[model samples]
Target: MTRGLSRRALLGGTVGGLALTTALTGPAATTATAATAATAATKTAGAGSRRGAVGPEPYVPVAVGAGGGPAGTDRVHVLKIGPDTAHTVLVLVPGMFGAAGDFRLLARDLVAAVPGVQVWAFDRREENLADRTGFATPDPAGYYLDGHYRSQDPTAAAYTAGWGLARTLDDLDTVVRMAACGGRRRVVLGGHSWGATTAMTYAAWDFDGRPGYRDLAALVVVDGGVRGAFKGTGQPVSDSPEQVRERLAAIDGGAVFDMTLSGVGLGSRAESTQIWYQLAGWYAHHDPAGRSVLQPRLPDALRPSSPLTNAGLLGTLVDVGFGWPNDISVHSGHLADADADGVRGWVDTGITPMSRVAAAYAGGPQPAVWEWYWPSRLSVDLDVADPYVDTDLARSLGLRLWHAEALDTPLYAFQTSYAKGTIVSGARDVVTNSRIPYGTYETDNGMTHLDPLFADTPHNTLTRTLAPFLTALR
Candidate 1:
């Protein structure tokens, strides 16, 4: 089932039964200075762990320009993981609404598993616009309360009207070039989910008459792709020119960013959906066992029969078998005490641990995992570009997928249970369409979409598979 660009499909519907009638007040807010201090402290503490070899420092933030656009609007942020001395660099692009921090755990494991390798997780230009005020405080409640009551939803940046795939590709090219270091090092480009589509799109993209695959030694796709036999809940293949034009016009009319969830009333309010996700994440990470303030606010259908802990609340929202659709569940199991009449807690029945999921959302030295101001224009362009099918309409929209038959890069793709065989089939399509000489595809039907990245196992499928693939390139 190739998914359309409906907001519900994109966001997996709203967190069940979230209805906020009033915003609760928080303690005195911390300043940006506090955020910087917190970040420095986090860097010193070093939250991520490496197994065999000493990896690169975590959360090293780097900024580069997309080559053109408004002065500050073109800036792209990257979180560097692994040692700088490593000669092999894997540039990882995040999925939609995802940030560099989404790859935090996976990057650490990859660097340790594969010697002489580093990972540079890419964050889109929009990440620069997120307000870090809530992240400045160490207290989870403080973070939650601040975002809930005080967060501001600024008007969408006018420049964002033009932040489509063309500009995004330009920004990615800059990062790839920097990581390549004038051909001194080997570079592999990879992405997860929508980012996987992005990597595939980039491989076939035309940059000033040059094919994008020439810049990379290999390609890696994690749980997403553009073409497949299954067509199960992935990106749409195309959009009508008239529809594209209407979307563009809407962007030009100041609807440049997506700030609301489609179905929920509270989420429809400016900034509420973003704030709720962040707060829930922080609460799950910092105070998993603590009583949740958010639970009482949820409608009975979504809320536990009894009070829930912070972790339980998050689990209820995201775990499979909790009445949520399987596509939206990041993990395989529900929280412990979920059915009990008292406070709920966590159980380790899933590939991704609740703590790790929380950390991804809670964030660290880098920006939060979720993008608060996802550019609406990128979706419009991606609908036309993701399939790697070139057309006159695509050319008109500056979406260049003209080099599908010319791509020569080796590909390795892994699929989680959420996508089943779709991702691997998509990889096959790329190899077949391009007549590419080399490709590898694997599927872990036991894991969720996020399991490859956040699974708390020593034998992570993604890590083991990707480590060997990248090491072979050496």
Candidate 2:
């Protein structure tokens, strides 16, 4: 797996910059070509034409979830871009509250980078849109309930990791079939946060009826969306939001602490809001546009929550084992470098976890499935030997419900010292200390939670330091 922004101006410089922008409004041949190329590029590249910075709009939703029978809570919207009949398809899974819109810049770059290829993004069914629309939830427990077949409740009943894992793999399998119907042969499964886990899980784990698990060309796990910390390795724990919170019980940290407290494993919607607000504010200092990117996703109900407060965000992160406390400062461990100052501040904050990440990186032939965002509870455990449901389907479905250790096998554990290839990345600002899951024991300092999605970011350094590693896929 290969893991993987901008700045503002001086107050006085903005006026001059605006005047320059206004004066250059002439549509000459160069501008015309740029526009033409951009348009052609979008059609060739699969850029969504959505408003704002997220490139062109998304492809007409061809089918909801692969074979088209909706598999998720959110209809899996799939869009295919490109005319190449026999091409490699990149299946993208977005993070929580993330939509196809999140891949704007990355899709454009990928289209331009890899010729004869298509990129597809899906909206998984995990979230309940009804809360926003004032409609009642279709399934009150929403698929992750304790007694449900997908639930990771062994003591409560029995384990079902397999159920949850199967759900994700099957979703991808459906998408793969739908995309394959159009004739794409090779597939690159890519995901961020929870999406990444789905992508990787599908990669390594075999789908019940799906054929050609061997046909997978690559896997991109962004941050440990699964069973462990940011790196993703370590025994999986079914730590509740409060339990995780308690682990990092200490506060009194600075900006880093504040960042973690504001954004990590907050159980309720209220906690997430507070952390996001702080992030929106902190990120605002660098970009003139501020964190408007958050406005679209951050619920209006959370407008009152203050995210900048240090304790809540950082404290929450520590407890969840996501954003780590600085080994040196022991205060906080999250930062962004979309802008010059942000980058500088990040560089100065403390030792980059990547730089000091000590791990043994050797592994074996590896499981085909690669789970990026590991589940916290045993939701549906496939690997476990339990009596919840005798059939395999029941356990497979459970993998989706809880965070389990087995899910992060290939990516986090050193069980694959002999394997020739692996795909992994973690975001720097991940609320989940997800990096561990990315490497069996080896750490890619270049990776951060979002690095795989943001080409310019540090996490997906493979795109930068080892372009051939990816481009060769062509």
Candidate 3:
């Protein structure tokens, strides 16, 4: 999965000098009015307010997999922002290896812009003690174990079995219902990168002969539409089926894929860290107040002006798959814009020395100081099947998740010109194969994959793109 800064300094000198921010124009004002009216009617119809008149609502951890029995280990955290009387909630899921914290900026922007619409960032249950410590495999420090499912050893099992595709879909189903607050609200489902895949899959899933996400009003996909990557053609997405099979085996076998530096033979956490620290440092130098915006989510030591030799902070990034080499990069078949000069400049600067990186690793903890960052087990499974499911000789190309007859939800895609293939192919497949009305919006801001989560301007692009679509929903 692919995964942005300041109020003035941040927005002023964006990468391409494009002002993605939009003023509250005629259409936007109309959309806000419609949203306000919709929420007012909900209040009149007798839905109690969950948020009292106050500051931003605090995030409430909702026990997901455990149902209503006991406080379960598998929990989905929800942060609600806006008028409590609102009946429409946009539930946004984070991309793989990304937590709910990633969507904080986007959620805040949406609530401030839309009059009555509330935004809930759904943090899927992911932390697995087993996977983080490398207990799932013989090698305790293997970076390949970064995104696998948790183990079910009776001695080590925290709650239930590790998650898979079926379970992830079920989890989203649970989150959707929870967001609905007893069916009083209409839910909009959206996600970025691999999170987009989860959203699309949930939209197409069949639950007891009905659409699993029956409450969903719309789908928003950002920079990812690979669910239908192989649609409408019998051609193999890879050059050869053998290649697909080989890659699948490697992914399942815990082979790490180096994505940071181009052709540098850097394939492990230590090697990658030496490069990432330089980037983080460089990014910090260029953006003065970026640390203020990022401090809430990023580790303290990684913040700008910190001593450049903080091994512990760098180690955390490796454990979470940011700099650490993992199978996900290879599995997704996209380097997530690491090839860009913005990403590569850190390594090109040659500031992070191998000696320092080695000393940092050696001085670090024995078990690699495992951070509580584990992706859904089912996500890894999907990576293995992406080649076949995204495309197929017999099914032509596209997703094999659900029958087209079952899809009737409205779909919207926000794509970049760089990855036009994903958006175009996915939209084509959804419209041609299903009854879902689809639309596509694009930007040429020349941002890397993770910019939307970090940049304020891109959110402006999102606002302009979604105004008409949301107004129509009213």
Candidate 4:
């Protein structure tokens, strides 16, 4: 258990912070309240209206940066949701291999539920390099199939050699400052998975002698936080300066920056696994009941024993009991139409529905829900900057986490069943070490790593918890 404002206190506006003192006042407060009430009313009425009033406008993508690196890879893209005039803003960062559109549904829900708040979902600089031509075509599946069969590899953008945490943090700081509006608005920074780790690291980051926490009102970490490499699967944590140097040297020596899904073999050919995942999502959304085009191509070891529909194929690729690596597993569910049909379908047993997952994957413009070119260098840098311990490796990599002990911002951490209890334990460590006056730690053992973002609204534990916290901050 952790100590903080109760949901009731938070929602009832009984909690106070420095934010309350700086909140909108007089006529400005009245206008904002009216706009929010109207927006809420529209949402409520739209629920029952057959015509279904259009929800908030589509997220507007805005590019921000000083234009650095190869072809300006330093530029970060933000999908802005809700009215810009809203005084309170929440900036969300996606996890490893995730993009701005990953938070599409969550951002809409938050904007609707919280008055005078907007969500800025950001795609890291690497997203600029993703190839969206296949997704943009009338025949996305066909387009992707052609590329897959040809074994097309993603471009090895060597400029990514410098795209480490330092560069990432710098890019994030640019966005944070833009959203903050020179201290006129309260900004809450949050992220999921690796993005969550980035959020905490950002709060503790040293920006030219100014501590990172001072720029924000609070923090939110969903299913991710600082931990040693020993505590997690996939990447190995660097324990020494030599190990860090070795990893950096590998990147400098033409190592690819993009990540591939584990357990799937595209034979000996070099192909883009990120594109394969996106193709799965495209088919799942557009032809759920249709026969899968990608399944027959998969190796026998990884393919389903029986023929499956596109949705079922996608479920097998991402669902938890299918033996796909945990890093890519998004839900827990079984196959359907097993006995009565020519092709099997998917049945979601987890909090998130398959349809929602499909939309998250397939429904955005460029830089959709997937980050095709995730920098390996960022992972290496995070390993060296483990918040719980300081090592000589951190200095060698130019990583700084010196402010966790002095951080004063309130933190809210929510964990899923995926990481057992380690996620919440990490949050506890942050609060304890920093002596943070307010912090909340929650666990929903029923949900998977990605469920918090895709789970249905109203019943979503993340939205329910996060809305109240953001409200209290105001």
Best by TM-score: 1
Off by over 4 Å in 4: 1-68, 148-156, 227-236, 256-263, 266-271, 338-341, 388-391
Residue-by-residue lDDT tens digits, candidate 2, 1-474: 211100111112223323332333333213223223223323322222231122333444332333222233324455444444537776677643344534534554556555666677664433212122101223222221222322112222111112244544565666777766545476766665446555545544544433333445655544433333223322233234454333223211111011212222222322232223223322222221222333234334222132211221221221112222221012213322223222111111221121111000000001001112222221223222121112443333333322222232223211111111122223221213322233322334433333333333232333342234346666
> Model 1: how large is the Cα RMSD against the reference?
7.7
The TM-scores of all predictions, comma-separated, are 0.83, 0.44, 0.56, 0.81
Clashes of 2: 122
lDDT of candidate 3 over 197-234, digit per residue (tens): 67777776666566654678887777655444423222
Q: Write the per-residue lDDT of candidate 1 for residues 41-123, one digit (tens) a residue.
A: 23322343323225344554445555344455556777787889889999999876777877877888887778899899998
Provide the lDDT at 112 for model 3.
58
Cα lDDT of model 4 by residue, 226-293, tens digit: 76412533344554667767777778777646333321443332235556777788877776667787
Mark the regions of model 2 whose C-alpha exceeds 4 Å error after superposition.
Answer: 1-55, 59-74, 79-86, 95-102, 127-163, 204-208, 212-215, 224-267, 270-443, 455-460, 465-467
Error of 3 at 133 (Å): 17
Question: What is each predicted model's overall lDDT from 0 to 1?
Answer: 0.67, 0.33, 0.43, 0.67
Give the runs in model 1 whose Cα sits over 4 Å from its true position.
1-63, 66-71, 138-156, 228-230, 234-238, 259-266, 269-271, 297-301, 338-341
lDDT of 4: 0.67
Q: Give the TM-score of candidate 2.
A: 0.44
Q: Distance (Å) between predicted and true CA of 120, model 3?
A: 1.2
Provide the clashing-pair count of each candidate structure.
4, 122, 11, 0
Error of 4 at 430 (Å): 1.3
